[model samples]
Target: MSADEGARHPEDITVPDAVSAPDAEGRPRRVTRRFPLFTRDTARPEGSGRAAPLDAPAPARQWPILAVLSLVGIGLLLTALDVFRYGTLLIGVALLGGAVLRWLLPGVGMLAVRSRFTDIATYGVLGLAIALLAMMAQPDPWLEIPFLKDTLHFTVSG
Candidate 1:
Protein backbone atom coordinates (compact mmCIF):
# COMPACT_ATOMS: atom_id res chain seq x y z
CA MET A 1 0.00 0.00 0.00
CA SER A 2 1.05 3.63 -0.57
CA ALA A 3 2.29 5.63 2.44
CA ASP A 4 -0.83 7.89 2.28
CA GLU A 5 -3.21 4.87 2.28
CA GLY A 6 -1.24 3.13 5.10
CA ALA A 7 -1.31 6.25 7.32
CA ARG A 8 -5.12 6.77 6.98
CA HIS A 9 -7.39 5.34 9.77
CA PRO A 10 -10.33 3.10 8.67
CA GLU A 11 -12.89 5.67 9.94
CA ASP A 12 -11.09 8.42 8.03
CA ILE A 13 -11.81 6.63 4.74
CA THR A 14 -15.03 8.27 3.49
CA VAL A 15 -17.13 6.89 0.61
CA PRO A 16 -17.28 9.29 -2.30
CA ASP A 17 -21.01 8.54 -2.84
CA ALA A 18 -21.86 9.71 0.72
CA VAL A 19 -20.23 13.13 0.15
CA SER A 20 -22.68 16.04 -0.34
CA ALA A 21 -22.92 17.61 -3.76
CA PRO A 22 -22.17 21.29 -4.31
CA ASP A 23 -25.18 23.58 -3.79
CA ALA A 24 -26.36 26.28 -6.27
CA GLU A 25 -24.04 28.80 -4.52
CA GLY A 26 -21.15 26.30 -4.94
CA ARG A 27 -20.94 25.57 -1.18
CA PRO A 28 -20.77 21.91 -0.04
CA ARG A 29 -24.26 21.23 1.51
CA ARG A 30 -23.50 18.95 4.46
CA VAL A 31 -26.33 16.93 6.05
CA THR A 32 -26.86 17.77 9.69
CA ARG A 33 -27.82 14.93 12.05
CA ARG A 34 -29.68 15.26 15.34
CA PHE A 35 -29.77 12.75 18.20
CA PRO A 36 -32.46 13.46 20.77
CA LEU A 37 -31.82 12.33 24.36
CA PHE A 38 -35.32 10.95 24.75
CA THR A 39 -37.26 8.94 22.18
CA ARG A 40 -41.06 9.17 21.67
CA ASP A 41 -41.90 6.68 24.42
CA THR A 42 -39.38 8.12 26.88
CA ALA A 43 -40.57 11.69 26.47
CA ARG A 44 -43.03 13.04 29.06
CA PRO A 45 -46.59 13.44 27.79
CA GLU A 46 -48.24 16.85 28.09
CA GLY A 47 -50.89 17.39 30.82
CA SER A 48 -50.25 14.01 32.42
CA GLY A 49 -47.68 13.14 35.11
CA ARG A 50 -47.15 12.94 38.85
CA ALA A 51 -45.50 16.38 39.12
CA ALA A 52 -46.01 19.50 37.03
CA PRO A 53 -43.44 22.02 35.91
CA LEU A 54 -42.32 24.47 38.64
CA ASP A 55 -43.79 27.49 36.82
CA ALA A 56 -47.31 26.02 36.74
CA PRO A 57 -49.76 26.89 39.49
CA ALA A 58 -50.11 24.30 42.23
CA PRO A 59 -53.20 22.07 42.19
CA ALA A 60 -56.02 22.71 44.70
CA ARG A 61 -55.78 19.20 46.20
CA GLN A 62 -52.32 20.02 47.60
CA TRP A 63 -53.84 22.34 50.24
CA PRO A 64 -53.62 19.73 53.00
CA ILE A 65 -49.89 19.35 52.44
CA LEU A 66 -49.50 23.11 52.32
CA ALA A 67 -51.26 23.42 55.65
CA VAL A 68 -49.05 20.76 57.23
CA LEU A 69 -45.91 22.42 55.91
CA SER A 70 -47.19 25.79 57.14
CA LEU A 71 -47.56 24.38 60.61
CA VAL A 72 -44.00 23.06 60.48
CA GLY A 73 -42.78 26.46 59.32
CA ILE A 74 -44.60 28.09 62.22
CA GLY A 75 -42.91 25.69 64.59
CA LEU A 76 -39.50 26.58 63.21
CA LEU A 77 -40.35 30.25 63.45
CA LEU A 78 -41.26 29.82 67.11
CA THR A 79 -37.96 28.01 67.76
CA ALA A 80 -36.06 30.87 66.08
CA LEU A 81 -37.92 33.35 68.32
CA ASP A 82 -36.43 31.61 71.44
CA VAL A 83 -39.58 29.79 72.55
CA PHE A 84 -37.79 26.44 72.61
CA ARG A 85 -40.39 24.59 74.71
CA TYR A 86 -43.55 25.18 72.71
CA GLY A 87 -41.64 25.48 69.44
CA THR A 88 -40.02 22.08 69.75
CA LEU A 89 -43.36 20.50 70.69
CA LEU A 90 -45.03 22.07 67.68
CA ILE A 91 -42.27 20.96 65.35
CA GLY A 92 -42.64 17.39 66.54
CA VAL A 93 -46.39 17.54 66.09
CA ALA A 94 -46.01 18.86 62.55
CA LEU A 95 -43.59 16.13 61.54
CA LEU A 96 -45.86 13.47 63.03
CA GLY A 97 -48.83 15.01 61.24
CA GLY A 98 -46.93 14.97 57.94
CA ALA A 99 -46.20 11.28 58.37
CA VAL A 100 -49.84 10.56 59.13
CA LEU A 101 -50.93 12.50 56.03
CA ARG A 102 -48.49 10.60 53.88
CA TRP A 103 -49.82 7.33 55.24
CA LEU A 104 -53.50 8.16 54.91
CA LEU A 105 -53.31 9.96 51.56
CA PRO A 106 -50.59 8.52 49.41
CA GLY A 107 -51.71 10.60 46.43
CA VAL A 108 -51.36 13.94 48.23
CA GLY A 109 -50.49 15.92 45.08
CA MET A 110 -47.25 17.95 45.37
CA LEU A 111 -46.75 16.92 48.99
CA ALA A 112 -45.74 13.48 47.79
CA VAL A 113 -42.26 14.74 47.08
CA ARG A 114 -40.83 11.26 47.12
CA SER A 115 -42.09 7.69 47.14
CA ARG A 116 -44.79 6.95 49.72
CA PHE A 117 -42.52 4.63 51.72
CA THR A 118 -39.64 7.12 51.89
CA ASP A 119 -41.84 10.07 52.90
CA ILE A 120 -43.53 8.07 55.65
CA ALA A 121 -40.26 6.69 57.01
CA THR A 122 -38.53 10.07 57.00
CA TYR A 123 -41.40 11.98 58.62
CA GLY A 124 -42.08 9.35 61.25
CA VAL A 125 -38.45 8.95 62.32
CA LEU A 126 -37.68 12.68 62.45
CA GLY A 127 -40.92 13.51 64.24
CA LEU A 128 -40.34 10.82 66.89
CA ALA A 129 -36.73 11.91 67.41
CA ILE A 130 -37.73 15.57 67.82
CA ALA A 131 -40.51 14.72 70.24
CA LEU A 132 -38.16 12.58 72.31
CA LEU A 133 -35.45 15.25 72.37
CA ALA A 134 -37.97 17.96 73.28
CA MET A 135 -39.22 15.85 76.18
CA MET A 136 -35.63 15.36 77.42
CA ALA A 137 -34.63 19.06 77.12
CA GLN A 138 -32.78 20.75 80.01
CA PRO A 139 -33.62 23.40 82.73
CA ASP A 140 -36.93 21.65 83.49
CA PRO A 141 -37.50 18.58 81.33
CA TRP A 142 -41.19 17.83 80.88
CA LEU A 143 -41.23 14.07 80.31
CA GLU A 144 -38.93 11.43 81.84
CA ILE A 145 -37.63 9.25 78.99
CA PRO A 146 -36.34 5.96 80.55
CA PHE A 147 -32.52 5.68 80.47
CA LEU A 148 -32.24 8.66 78.03
CA LYS A 149 -30.89 10.96 80.76
CA ASP A 150 -28.09 8.52 81.64
CA THR A 151 -27.41 7.87 77.97
CA LEU A 152 -27.11 11.58 77.24
CA HIS A 153 -24.81 12.04 80.22
CA PHE A 154 -22.53 9.20 79.13
CA THR A 155 -22.40 10.42 75.50
CA VAL A 156 -21.74 14.00 76.53
CA SER A 157 -19.08 13.22 79.16
CA GLY A 158 -17.01 10.83 77.08
Candidate 2:
Protein backbone atom coordinates (compact mmCIF):
# COMPACT_ATOMS: atom_id res chain seq x y z
CA MET A 1 0.00 0.00 0.00
CA SER A 2 1.14 3.54 -0.76
CA ALA A 3 2.21 5.89 2.12
CA ASP A 4 -0.62 8.25 1.25
CA GLU A 5 -3.23 5.43 1.47
CA GLY A 6 -1.86 4.21 4.90
CA ALA A 7 -1.98 7.76 6.29
CA ARG A 8 -5.59 8.14 5.21
CA HIS A 9 -6.68 4.96 7.06
CA PRO A 10 -8.70 5.24 10.43
CA GLU A 11 -6.06 3.17 12.40
CA ASP A 12 -3.25 5.56 11.39
CA ILE A 13 -4.00 8.22 14.08
CA THR A 14 -4.81 6.92 17.59
CA VAL A 15 -7.15 9.34 19.50
CA PRO A 16 -7.82 8.42 23.17
CA ASP A 17 -11.47 8.27 24.25
CA ALA A 18 -12.83 9.43 27.65
CA VAL A 19 -13.26 5.77 28.78
CA SER A 20 -9.46 5.17 28.86
CA ALA A 21 -7.74 5.66 32.26
CA PRO A 22 -4.30 7.24 32.88
CA ASP A 23 -1.23 4.93 33.06
CA ALA A 24 0.99 4.68 36.19
CA GLU A 25 3.51 7.38 35.14
CA GLY A 26 0.82 9.61 33.53
CA ARG A 27 -1.43 11.59 35.94
CA PRO A 28 -4.39 13.33 34.32
CA ARG A 29 -4.21 17.14 34.26
CA ARG A 30 -6.12 18.58 37.27
CA VAL A 31 -9.03 20.87 36.43
CA THR A 32 -9.33 24.02 38.64
CA ARG A 33 -12.37 23.53 40.91
CA ARG A 34 -13.97 26.30 42.97
CA PHE A 35 -15.43 25.63 46.41
CA PRO A 36 -18.20 27.74 47.97
CA LEU A 37 -17.83 28.91 51.60
CA PHE A 38 -20.83 26.83 52.73
CA THR A 39 -19.55 23.59 51.14
CA ARG A 40 -18.60 20.88 53.69
CA ASP A 41 -16.63 18.16 51.82
CA THR A 42 -14.57 20.62 49.71
CA ALA A 43 -13.52 22.72 52.75
CA ARG A 44 -9.95 22.35 54.06
CA PRO A 45 -8.01 23.88 57.00
CA GLU A 46 -6.20 27.25 56.56
CA GLY A 47 -2.62 26.21 57.39
CA SER A 48 -2.18 23.07 59.49
CA GLY A 49 -4.21 19.89 60.04
CA ARG A 50 -7.18 19.23 62.41
CA ALA A 51 -7.44 21.48 65.51
CA ALA A 52 -7.39 20.41 69.19
CA PRO A 53 -10.52 18.78 70.62
CA LEU A 54 -13.03 21.02 72.45
CA ASP A 55 -12.86 18.82 75.59
CA ALA A 56 -9.04 19.11 75.88
CA PRO A 57 -7.84 21.01 78.97
CA ALA A 58 -6.01 24.32 78.56
CA PRO A 59 -2.63 25.28 80.05
CA ALA A 60 -2.64 26.61 83.64
CA ARG A 61 -1.55 30.23 84.32
CA GLN A 62 0.53 31.37 87.32
CA TRP A 63 0.91 34.62 89.31
CA PRO A 64 4.51 35.45 90.28
CA ILE A 65 3.20 38.52 92.22
CA LEU A 66 1.27 36.22 94.58
CA ALA A 67 4.45 34.29 95.39
CA VAL A 68 6.34 37.54 96.08
CA LEU A 69 3.52 38.81 98.30
CA SER A 70 3.58 35.56 100.33
CA LEU A 71 7.35 35.85 100.79
CA VAL A 72 6.90 39.49 101.95
CA GLY A 73 4.26 38.39 104.46
CA ILE A 74 6.64 35.75 105.88
CA GLY A 75 9.46 38.31 106.11
CA LEU A 76 7.19 40.79 107.93
CA LEU A 77 6.11 38.10 110.44
CA LEU A 78 9.76 37.19 111.09
CA THR A 79 10.66 40.86 111.62
CA ALA A 80 7.76 41.29 114.04
CA LEU A 81 8.89 38.26 116.10
CA ASP A 82 12.58 39.27 116.21
CA VAL A 83 12.02 42.68 117.95
CA PHE A 84 15.49 43.70 116.64
CA ARG A 85 16.29 47.44 116.52
CA TYR A 86 18.77 46.92 113.67
CA GLY A 87 16.12 45.10 111.60
CA THR A 88 13.64 47.99 112.06
CA LEU A 89 16.34 50.54 111.18
CA LEU A 90 17.40 48.55 108.12
CA ILE A 91 13.85 48.33 106.74
CA GLY A 92 13.10 52.00 107.50
CA VAL A 93 16.36 53.25 105.97
CA ALA A 94 16.25 51.00 102.91
CA LEU A 95 12.62 51.70 101.93
CA LEU A 96 12.43 55.37 102.99
CA GLY A 97 15.94 56.23 101.76
CA GLY A 98 15.37 54.55 98.41
CA ALA A 99 12.14 56.54 97.97
CA VAL A 100 13.96 59.75 98.92
CA LEU A 101 16.87 58.96 96.59
CA ARG A 102 14.51 58.43 93.65
CA TRP A 103 12.99 61.85 94.36
CA LEU A 104 16.36 63.55 94.98
CA LEU A 105 17.57 63.13 91.33
CA PRO A 106 17.98 66.47 89.39
CA GLY A 107 14.56 66.98 87.74
CA VAL A 108 12.60 65.16 90.52
CA GLY A 109 14.24 66.91 93.48
CA MET A 110 12.01 70.01 93.54
CA LEU A 111 8.71 68.06 93.68
CA ALA A 112 10.19 65.59 96.18
CA VAL A 113 11.38 68.43 98.45
CA ARG A 114 7.98 70.11 98.24
CA SER A 115 6.16 66.88 99.16
CA ARG A 116 8.60 66.15 102.05
CA PHE A 117 8.28 69.67 103.47
CA THR A 118 4.45 69.63 103.23
CA ASP A 119 4.29 66.23 104.97
CA ILE A 120 6.82 67.30 107.67
CA ALA A 121 5.06 70.60 108.43
CA THR A 122 1.56 69.08 108.52
CA TYR A 123 2.65 66.14 110.70
CA GLY A 124 4.76 68.43 112.93
CA VAL A 125 1.79 70.71 113.69
CA LEU A 126 -0.46 67.73 114.37
CA GLY A 127 2.18 66.19 116.66
CA LEU A 128 2.57 69.43 118.66
CA ALA A 129 -1.21 69.83 119.18
CA ILE A 130 -1.52 66.22 120.37
CA ALA A 131 1.40 66.68 122.82
CA LEU A 132 -0.18 69.84 124.36
CA LEU A 133 -3.58 68.10 124.73
CA ALA A 134 -2.04 64.98 126.34
CA MET A 135 -0.02 67.11 128.78
CA MET A 136 -3.01 69.15 129.93
CA ALA A 137 -5.31 66.09 130.30
CA GLN A 138 -5.42 63.75 133.36
CA PRO A 139 -2.99 60.77 133.70
CA ASP A 140 -5.74 58.48 132.24
CA PRO A 141 -7.46 60.07 129.23
CA TRP A 142 -10.12 58.41 127.08
CA LEU A 143 -8.43 59.72 123.88
CA GLU A 144 -4.84 58.65 123.16
CA ILE A 145 -2.77 60.26 120.37
CA PRO A 146 0.23 58.21 119.22
CA PHE A 147 2.24 61.30 118.15
CA LEU A 148 2.13 62.66 121.78
CA LYS A 149 3.38 59.49 123.52
CA ASP A 150 5.92 56.81 122.54
CA THR A 151 4.19 54.24 124.79
CA LEU A 152 0.39 54.85 124.87
CA HIS A 153 -1.51 52.53 127.23
CA PHE A 154 -4.41 52.61 129.73
CA THR A 155 -3.58 51.68 133.35
CA VAL A 156 -6.51 50.90 135.62
CA SER A 157 -6.23 51.05 139.47
CA GLY A 158 -8.92 49.49 141.68
Candidate 3:
Protein backbone atom coordinates (compact mmCIF):
# COMPACT_ATOMS: atom_id res chain seq x y z
CA MET A 1 0.00 0.00 0.00
CA SER A 2 1.13 3.56 -0.76
CA ALA A 3 2.25 5.67 2.26
CA ASP A 4 -0.58 8.32 1.75
CA GLU A 5 -3.30 5.79 0.97
CA GLY A 6 -6.29 6.42 3.39
CA ALA A 7 -3.90 7.70 6.10
CA ARG A 8 -6.61 9.83 7.82
CA HIS A 9 -9.23 7.48 9.25
CA PRO A 10 -12.90 8.80 9.80
CA GLU A 11 -12.89 7.36 13.36
CA ASP A 12 -9.98 9.66 14.36
CA ILE A 13 -12.06 12.88 13.73
CA THR A 14 -14.39 14.20 16.52
CA VAL A 15 -17.83 15.16 15.19
CA PRO A 16 -19.92 17.90 16.86
CA ASP A 17 -23.07 16.95 18.89
CA ALA A 18 -25.44 18.33 16.17
CA VAL A 19 -24.30 15.58 13.74
CA SER A 20 -26.21 12.34 14.22
CA ALA A 21 -24.32 9.29 15.52
CA PRO A 22 -25.31 5.71 14.79
CA ASP A 23 -27.01 3.67 17.55
CA ALA A 24 -26.16 -0.02 18.28
CA GLU A 25 -28.87 -0.99 15.75
CA GLY A 26 -26.88 0.75 12.97
CA ARG A 27 -29.67 3.49 12.58
CA PRO A 28 -28.71 7.18 12.95
CA ARG A 29 -30.00 8.67 16.27
CA ARG A 30 -31.01 12.33 16.43
CA VAL A 31 -29.08 14.71 18.75
CA THR A 32 -31.78 16.36 20.96
CA ARG A 33 -29.60 18.96 22.77
CA ARG A 34 -29.05 22.41 21.24
CA PHE A 35 -25.66 24.13 21.05
CA PRO A 36 -24.99 27.70 22.22
CA LEU A 37 -24.98 30.49 19.63
CA PHE A 38 -21.37 31.39 20.48
CA THR A 39 -18.38 29.24 21.40
CA ARG A 40 -17.56 29.34 25.14
CA ASP A 41 -15.12 32.03 26.21
CA THR A 42 -11.76 30.44 27.09
CA ALA A 43 -11.00 33.04 29.81
CA ARG A 44 -14.13 32.48 31.99
CA PRO A 45 -15.92 29.11 31.65
CA GLU A 46 -18.54 29.62 34.40
CA GLY A 47 -19.47 33.20 33.30
CA SER A 48 -19.85 32.14 29.66
CA GLY A 49 -22.11 29.18 30.55
CA ARG A 50 -24.70 31.29 32.45
CA ALA A 51 -26.30 34.67 31.82
CA ALA A 52 -27.13 37.31 34.43
CA PRO A 53 -30.81 37.35 35.60
CA LEU A 54 -32.80 40.25 34.04
CA ASP A 55 -36.09 40.16 36.05
CA ALA A 56 -36.75 43.28 38.15
CA PRO A 57 -38.18 43.56 41.66
CA ALA A 58 -41.95 44.06 42.16
CA PRO A 59 -43.19 47.64 42.43
CA ALA A 60 -44.23 48.91 45.88
CA ARG A 61 -47.92 48.87 46.74
CA GLN A 62 -49.95 52.13 46.89
CA TRP A 63 -53.31 52.04 48.76
CA PRO A 64 -54.01 55.67 49.61
CA ILE A 65 -54.21 56.64 45.95
CA LEU A 66 -56.86 53.99 45.32
CA ALA A 67 -59.01 55.20 48.22
CA VAL A 68 -58.77 58.85 47.15
CA LEU A 69 -59.61 57.95 43.56
CA SER A 70 -62.67 56.04 44.72
CA LEU A 71 -63.89 58.97 46.79
CA VAL A 72 -63.40 61.37 43.86
CA GLY A 73 -65.38 59.05 41.55
CA ILE A 74 -68.31 58.97 44.00
CA GLY A 75 -68.27 62.77 44.35
CA LEU A 76 -68.23 63.11 40.55
CA LEU A 77 -71.32 60.88 40.32
CA LEU A 78 -73.20 63.05 42.81
CA THR A 79 -72.17 66.24 40.98
CA ALA A 80 -73.33 64.81 37.65
CA LEU A 81 -76.83 64.19 39.12
CA ASP A 82 -77.19 67.96 39.77
CA VAL A 83 -78.00 67.22 43.40
CA PHE A 84 -74.70 68.72 44.59
CA ARG A 85 -74.43 72.52 44.66
CA TYR A 86 -70.61 72.40 44.90
CA GLY A 87 -69.88 70.68 41.60
CA THR A 88 -66.73 72.72 41.06
CA LEU A 89 -65.50 71.83 44.51
CA LEU A 90 -65.97 68.12 43.81
CA ILE A 91 -64.16 68.47 40.46
CA GLY A 92 -61.36 70.41 42.13
CA VAL A 93 -61.00 67.73 44.75
CA ALA A 94 -60.63 65.08 42.05
CA LEU A 95 -58.02 67.12 40.22
CA LEU A 96 -56.20 67.82 43.47
CA GLY A 97 -56.24 64.13 44.29
CA GLY A 98 -54.54 63.37 40.97
CA ALA A 99 -52.00 66.09 41.61
CA VAL A 100 -51.25 64.63 45.01
CA LEU A 101 -50.74 61.16 43.56
CA ARG A 102 -48.44 62.55 40.91
CA TRP A 103 -46.45 64.37 43.55
CA LEU A 104 -46.27 61.47 45.99
CA LEU A 105 -45.55 58.59 43.58
CA PRO A 106 -44.32 59.96 40.31
CA GLY A 107 -43.34 56.55 38.96
CA VAL A 108 -46.83 55.10 39.50
CA GLY A 109 -48.86 58.19 38.52
CA MET A 110 -50.34 58.57 35.03
CA LEU A 111 -48.47 61.32 33.16
CA ALA A 112 -51.57 62.30 31.16
CA VAL A 113 -53.60 62.87 34.31
CA ARG A 114 -50.95 65.15 35.80
CA SER A 115 -50.63 67.27 32.65
CA ARG A 116 -54.41 67.48 32.15
CA PHE A 117 -55.10 68.46 35.77
CA THR A 118 -52.73 71.42 35.50
CA ASP A 119 -54.68 72.82 32.57
CA ILE A 120 -58.07 71.86 34.02
CA ALA A 121 -57.43 73.72 37.25
CA THR A 122 -56.16 76.81 35.45
CA TYR A 123 -59.09 77.04 33.03
CA GLY A 124 -61.62 75.96 35.66
CA VAL A 125 -60.64 78.84 37.94
CA LEU A 126 -60.86 81.28 35.02
CA GLY A 127 -64.25 79.96 33.96
CA LEU A 128 -65.58 80.28 37.52
CA ALA A 129 -64.36 83.88 37.67
CA ILE A 130 -66.07 84.76 34.36
CA ALA A 131 -69.30 83.08 35.45
CA LEU A 132 -69.32 85.06 38.69
CA LEU A 133 -68.69 88.28 36.76
CA ALA A 134 -71.60 87.60 34.41
CA MET A 135 -73.90 86.77 37.31
CA MET A 136 -73.07 90.11 38.95
CA ALA A 137 -73.51 92.13 35.73
CA GLN A 138 -76.93 90.83 34.55
CA PRO A 139 -80.35 90.96 36.25
CA ASP A 140 -82.33 87.77 36.94
CA PRO A 141 -84.19 86.30 33.93
CA TRP A 142 -87.49 86.20 35.98
CA LEU A 143 -87.73 90.04 36.28
CA GLU A 144 -90.31 91.88 34.03
CA ILE A 145 -89.72 94.92 31.78
CA PRO A 146 -91.87 98.06 32.38
CA PHE A 147 -92.43 99.27 28.73
CA LEU A 148 -94.25 96.18 27.35
CA LYS A 149 -96.50 95.60 30.40
CA ASP A 150 -99.91 95.31 28.59
CA THR A 151 -98.75 93.58 25.34
CA LEU A 152 -97.03 90.59 26.99
CA HIS A 153 -99.30 87.58 27.70
CA PHE A 154 -98.62 85.12 30.54
CA THR A 155 -100.33 81.96 29.23
CA VAL A 156 -98.83 79.60 26.66
CA SER A 157 -100.84 79.24 23.38
CA GLY A 158 -99.77 75.73 22.41
Strongest candidate by TM-score: 1
lDDT of 1 by residue, 81-111 (tens): 9988788888888888888877875355656
Error of 1 at 38 (Å): 8.7
Clashes of 3: 0
- True-vs-predicted CA distance for residue 42, candidate 2, Å: 49
**Angstrom error at residue 12, model 3:** 48
Error of 3 at 143 (Å): 24
Question: What TM-score does each of the candidates earn?
Answer: 0.58, 0.21, 0.29
lDDT-better candidate, 1 vs 3: 1
Q: Name the better of 1 and 3 by TM-score.
A: 1
Sort order, lDDT high to low? 1, 3, 2
Candidate lDDT scores, in order, read 0.72, 0.39, 0.46
Each prediction's Cα RMSD? 12.6, 29.7, 23.0
Scanning candidate 3 in windows of ten residues, the lowest lDDT window is 44-53
lDDT tens per residue, model 3, 1-158: 88777575654544477548789997778865765445445342111211112243222133434545665577668768873534435545655554454444424322223344463465456445533433333245233445444444433332
Error of 2 at 117 (Å): 9.6
> What C-alpha lDDT, on a 0 to 100 scale, does residue 134 get in candidate 2?
38
Off by over 4 Å in 1: 1-59, 155-158
